[model samples]
Target: MGKGGSSKDTYNIAHQKGTPGAGGNRGDRLIKEMIHDPYKTRSKLPEPTVCPECQALFQQGRWAWAEVPPNANQELCPACQRIRDRAPAGFLMLSGAFFQEHREEIINLIRNKEKSEKAQHPLKRIMDIEEQEGETVVTFTEIHLPRGVGEALNRAYEGELDYQYTDETSILRVRWHR
Candidate 1:
């Protein structure tokens, strides 16, 4: 039990940090501003909008791979915008001797994973794949896809997998080496 309350009240106070009657001090009442993504729309975009670049249909409050309906408004989907800007929300890095040896297999696995994820989610996409001096860097439009790809690689190849998520920059970095 917390100070001056039953377990349920204590639970509520702990869980609802800034809510009313949470029994917190002034600092706890202050609502922190959400981490901002510059690409995210400030307001809900009009429904049934389609991206001109990739033809991704925005309908039913989400983006999907549906056929563009008649009289749909044209707008750039976030994934295409991110691709055009080359500003990836996620990065997957592959390195080490084993990775260099099995590069083609790894890349094929990544592409397959991306294809499956992109079929379901229009926003999750691979922006680019670049080979640096000693590492292969793959960038994604959305932050979660890289992590998923890294986990898939780890599962298939038994590599060393690590993830770093930066809240300030709103990016997820996934590294896999075997």
Candidate 2:
């Protein structure tokens, strides 16, 4: 009933003509098939070079490059990859008098602990130690805390601790109070 073609015409073309190699085994069907064979030889296509982390392919058509290749590092893209790769997986947020009093001690303890533990697990890294106004924030990545790390922290410093978990990562947010 439409201007292009009727339903009956489509049905007739779909079935009546008996398309070449139709009514064949479904298991052996080609993944990508064209109306006519485009390739002269029957061979698998070559795989494109892809980033192992993000699985992004390097295509000549899509991207323009002038000798200096971009995103040479596997960690992240040139601009954002460094920040994301270096960003801490976990953070400790502290505010008020507690931060001012125990900032150095807390940082030293965490750094020492991290250094000792990193020998066993090299993937664990400390990203940053920052103090802003009355707040102190420590950021770390790939840190695996023991069972008593939380309880000991609470006992030593008066603060609230928050934690978040995702499929691939976990974030710890700690708030210290006087």
Candidate 3:
């Protein structure tokens, strides 16, 4: 809350005496911006550049695969930038007894899924994968990739898949377990 009138103070002056009116549904009053994905590149990126890291071509208003033009503008794509910054926007949590037993297979599947998506959409990328003591977490540069991974795992392994989009931060979290 801000300093002056920002407090969440409620007043009931209308219903001071007698009968109460019907309660109307408060729709947007308390709703926060529920964002599934937030992009960091707000400013216009450098034009028609080639990302040496991913070998992706940034041309014709978006990323694509093209032969490096003569003196092609070279710059890092958003995905590579996210990886370099280590600031992931998507999170996938893989855990459960079943996950422990099939760690390698599941991890391979996730990697393959990411690879396929990355081929089509250069912005979709896996930032990091961490194997913790009991759980494995996969971080992504884009929201759709993690959800895609969770969906792929669910399709392949018939696991329990849960997804949530945060209201404030707009971060996407996905949990897959058997």
Choose the strongest candidate by lDDT. 1
Whichever of 2 and 3 has more lDDT, that candidate is: 3
Q: What would the TM-scores of all predictions be?
A: 0.82, 0.43, 0.75
Deviation in angstroms for 114 in model 2?
Answer: 1.1
> How many clashes (backbone atoms < 3 Å, residues ≥3 apart in a chain or on different chains) does model 3 have?
0
Off by over 4 Å in 1: 1-32
lDDT of 1: 0.88
lDDT for predicted candidate 3 compared with the true structure:
0.80
Q: What is the number of residue pairs that collide in model 2?
A: 0
Residue-level lDDT tens digits of model 1 in 1-178: 5568898876576667455553444324556666878888777878889999999998888899998988999999999999889899999999998998899998999999999999999899998899887799999999989999999998899979999998888999999988
Model 1 CA lDDT for position 6? 98
User: Compared with the true structure, what per-residue lDDT tens digits does model 3 show for residues 41-137?
Assistant: 5656666789889888987788877787777877888788888888788899999988889999999999999889877888888888898667899
lDDT by candidate, in order shown: 0.88, 0.48, 0.80
Tens digits of lDDT, candidate 2, 43-147 = 322233333443333344221122333543232222123236565545666565665677677667667776765554433446677776657766655434421
Lowest lDDT 10-residue stretch of candidate 1 = 19-28
lDDT score, candidate 3, position 160:
89
Candidate 2 local lDDT, residue 73: 26
Error of 2 at 43 (Å): 26
What lDDT score goes with residue 113 in model 1?
99
Give the CA lDDT, 0 to 100, for residue 50 in model 3: 93
